[model samples]
Every structure is written in C-alpha cells, then in structure tokens.
Target: MAVYTYTVDNANLAVQDLSTGESLTDIFTYTITDSDGDTATTTLTITIDGVNDGAQQGAMKSKSWSQA
Candidate 1:
C-alpha cells in the first residue's frame, strides 16, 4: 500500500470574478511517488464563475444579492 497527501495555496489568486468582465487563472499540480522508486506528476486548471449582481463593490465579494 502507498500513502499520499495534498496541499493548496491561493495567496496570489485574483480577487475578481469571470462574470465581472474579468478572468482569473488557478493552477494545481500534484505529484506521487511510490516506494518502488516510481514517480508520476499531474496538473489541473480551474475557472470560477462570477456573480451577475447589478452592484459593483470595486472588488470581488464573497457574497452578493439583488432586490426585486
């Protein structure tokens, strides 16, 4: 049997959303190694959707809402 662990860091991620006419990129990478001296690596990309609220907060907000 083998063991694996993963970690993430987003200190440099953009604070804007894609729906606000802005786009951001987040890259993820992982590596695995076995006791038999075998190693493998992989990468993944992710994109988040922005809210369409009618108000602008000068930056990306964690929450948003509208009144009818």
Candidate 2:
C-alpha cells in the first residue's frame, strides 16, 4: 500500500469584497507526495461568492436641551 500526503502552499485566503451578482476567484498551488518519494503538484482554483452584510453603527450619546 502507498501512503500519500497532501500539502497546500497557501491556506490563508482573504474574504471577497461585497458586490451585487459578483464572484471572486482565487488560485493556489498544492502538492501531493507518496511514500515512494514521488510528488505531484498542481494549481487549484476556488470561487468565492458575494454576500450582503448588515449596516455598521457607531457609538451614540444623549444630550439635554432647555427652552425658555
């Protein structure tokens, strides 16, 4: 039996920007090695879909006013 090991050159992927009906593609390289010291490398392509996020808010304060 041959034991195989897999490795990825880059595993840290950034999140895609928010858009309407848009997607992003990211490419990376990976390698597979066997117990016989043979290695196979190839490029992998991944697609990231766009999503909608809720609005961001900041801190709020209260003030008092008087009228004469």
**Candidate 2 deviant stretches above 4 angstroms:** 1-16, 59-68
TM-score between model 1 and native: 0.42
Question: Candidate 1: which stretches are off by over 4 Å?
Answer: 1-13, 17-22, 54-68
What are the RMSDs of all candidates, in order?
10.0, 8.5
Q: Evaluate residue 34 in candidate 2 and report its C-alpha lDDT on the 0 to 100 scale.
A: 85
**Clashes (candidate 1):** 0
Cα lDDT of all candidates, in order? Answer: 0.60, 0.62
Looking at candidate 1, what is the lDDT of residue 33? 87
lDDT of 1 at 26: 67
Task: Estimate the TM-score for candidate 2.
Answer: 0.48
Q: Which candidate gets the maximum TM-score versus the true structure?
A: 2
